[model samples]
Target chain A: MRNLADEIERFILRKLAGETNDITILQRNELADELSCAPSQISYVLSTRFTAERGFIVQSRRGSGGFVRIVRVPVQKIVYNKPDNIMDYCSPEDFENIIIKLNSERMITAREAGLIKYFLDVIDDYVNPVEKMRIFRSLLITLENNS
Target chain B: MRNLADEIERFILRKLAGETNDITILQRNELADELSCAPSQISYVLSTRFTAERGFIVQSRRGSGGFVRIVRVPVQKIVYNKPDNIMDYCSPEDFENIIIKLNSERMITAREAGLIKYFLDVIDDYVNPVEKMRIFRSLLITLENNS
Candidate 1:
């Protein structure tokens, strides 16, 4: 039997692959009914599978006419010959490629991507893991919540 | 009389300024007694003042050998002689200087600096003012959260 998280993730990916761009809205209760799960289960799926890192922007409205909208971002096309060299050296072109790809692939909303790019520049001059993690986590959380 | 809030805040800040990184082993009840305040006051101070937003991290243990530890983070120095001089013209040398200073002062972790350099490349590529602000805010928030 497929678990709820897996089900939700599959459903979301399917929607993204199908070219659903203008906010795929779903009501919590209605989705729960359709999936035979609790409303909180929907929240769980949104929190985990649709995180900013993996690249999906989720928004919701509460009360009547309430619905959750998921936007798909586009992925960038950069020819990486070696995956091992991914973070070895990050240049402006590399960062831009990632952002462009993330936006196009629907991994991040335009607003979230914009925010992330801004943060990347500010911390660019600093060289420390603790600080990088700090910035990365903060941007991730903000994008997750705001998107 | 200085209230518990004021006293605890001062004590924590003083310890932090004195280069104390670990303070979790301190006994709450004993601390309250030393300050002639209620134990709950300590809890209140920890929750409100030492939050991640304030750049202080707090952790506590309960039961036998229970204690509270607080770590104070040193404030980041943006490094320009004038605060009004926006970081628009920072050279590679300037960037390197900031990293060295932060590392020597123990202000940022090595990983954080690496991430920052990655982000810097992104900022250098973007020419738009709005884009710059967004990136700057994102990096600042990330730095603030990590430290």
Candidate 2:
């Protein structure tokens, strides 16, 4: 049996996949009741799985009108038919698409994909993955704050 | 005389080197008993040595059918060598030399080279360095495991 965390993560991702770009607001108590899990369990799933590093932004308002809002950030997509063509003349869009495909295909490990996403978001150079992730993260922060 | 932790660490590294994907899973208590050390010693070695920063991920499950899995994250390698002839393909030995040349030129980082070595062991493909490394790492863990 899948853990509650994984189940909740899949539920949120399934919902996010159906929509293009929008914030999904859900009441914690209602969500918890539906999942038959504690409110803290929902919080744990959100914090760990739906992190900004994974191309998601989550915000919450606590109180009687308490609700968690999740936004799926738009990311670029790349397509290649053959493995030999994977790295040829990659544009920013191409890189993002490659990452999206890799993640969707479950080709790269989650941690490895996270590292690559970080590079795409931060690094400017067409170089190493570690540096790439760092640069991508920096760029993302700059873009997010400015826009 | 090697400490129990050192012995166990060496044993794990040897196993990793012999394998293509270089990931090893074992039971903590079983390994500890075999090494004549406390289970905490295994944890100590894992914490000190097999860290994400050190290119290893340690995951464990507690209780029935529990096991500790150690996965080594291969580093990425950048290669700049290109063969002249279109028809004549490079052998594994030729590819190995290309890696050495890149390493000597300081074109590829040590971590990148390590990842390349891991990739070479896993993927059997003939292509340019950038594409070869990219494709290999991109699909290393996913392809066979899925089926």
Candidate 3:
């Protein structure tokens, strides 16, 4: 990572993490001055790090008085209702249902959902349903763990 | 991979590889007829494997006489020509350059690049530079190997 870009991202992340509402608005010039980088650099950081697919909504307007607003959205709703070995017992339909729920909740983007749905469809065609369930379950568990 | 899907992918790959130009056009119905599979199955393979991120450009038309077109794009023009063990010898700037190129080439979605770039930033913050290079090199090498 470029040090400046990373610094800008972390700086924004820290600001967002500290906000209870999960929203932050800041000036490009002020942040650039603080970070000792050009304002353009801050814009690049915001555009890349705070994207819609990454669960962030960014609103910005041009002009000196304008500010950049970023809203952090949850990537997933983590609820462990099942036992520890969830993957061992879940069905493919269960996987599909949970993914649909997550998508509905805006945890993952529609593009990702499409990609994953196609993957599942292909896996279903080749693998046994039971084995496919295991794969999907493991993937969900991994995402949860990572989250 | 599903046996039929794999076969179809190989068929397309062979067609592309054999092309004097880096483009191929074929009707989905014709492919399905040859493979003895549903036309939708051909779509699944095309959408997944021939994605822009995977260095492909796909164009399609619908209705009767519609055709699916595939274009093979170079991925590695994004970066290369470093030493045999460049990751062991390069700086974070090198890593950033590679990723930026990949993003410009649409080899990875911006969200993925942001995730990676942010992770690298945190790693740079806490980890020694040498260790960071090793990680960066390893990621690039893995991608190359997989490609």
Alpha carbon lDDT at A101, candidate 3: 64
Shift of residue B38 alpha carbon in model 1, Å: 3.2
Scored against the true structure, residue A125 in model 3 reaches a CA lDDT of 46
lDDT digits (tens) for residues A27-78 of candidate 2: 7889889999998989988988877555577898988887898986533221
Candidate 2 runs further than 4 Å off: A1-7, A60-66, A75-147, B1-37, B44-69, B72-147
Expressed as tens digits, the lDDT of each residue in B29-84 for candidate 2 is 98888888899999999999887567676778886457888876543222111223
Q: Report the Cα lDDT for residue B61, model 1.
A: 66
Write out fnat for all predictions, comma-separated.
0.05, 0.00, 0.00
Worst 10 residues of 3 chain B by lDDT: B138-147
Worst lDDT 10-window in candidate 1 chain B: B74-83
Q: What would the per-residue lDDT of candidate 1 be over residues A1-147, giving only the tens digit for each residue?
A: 345767877876676667635357677898788889998988998987887655556888898898888864322212233252245455656666766775675555454455456665555665454455444544443333322
Query: Interface Cα RMSD for candidate 2?
Result: 14.2
Models ranked on TM-score: 2, 1, 3
lDDT of 1 at A85: 28
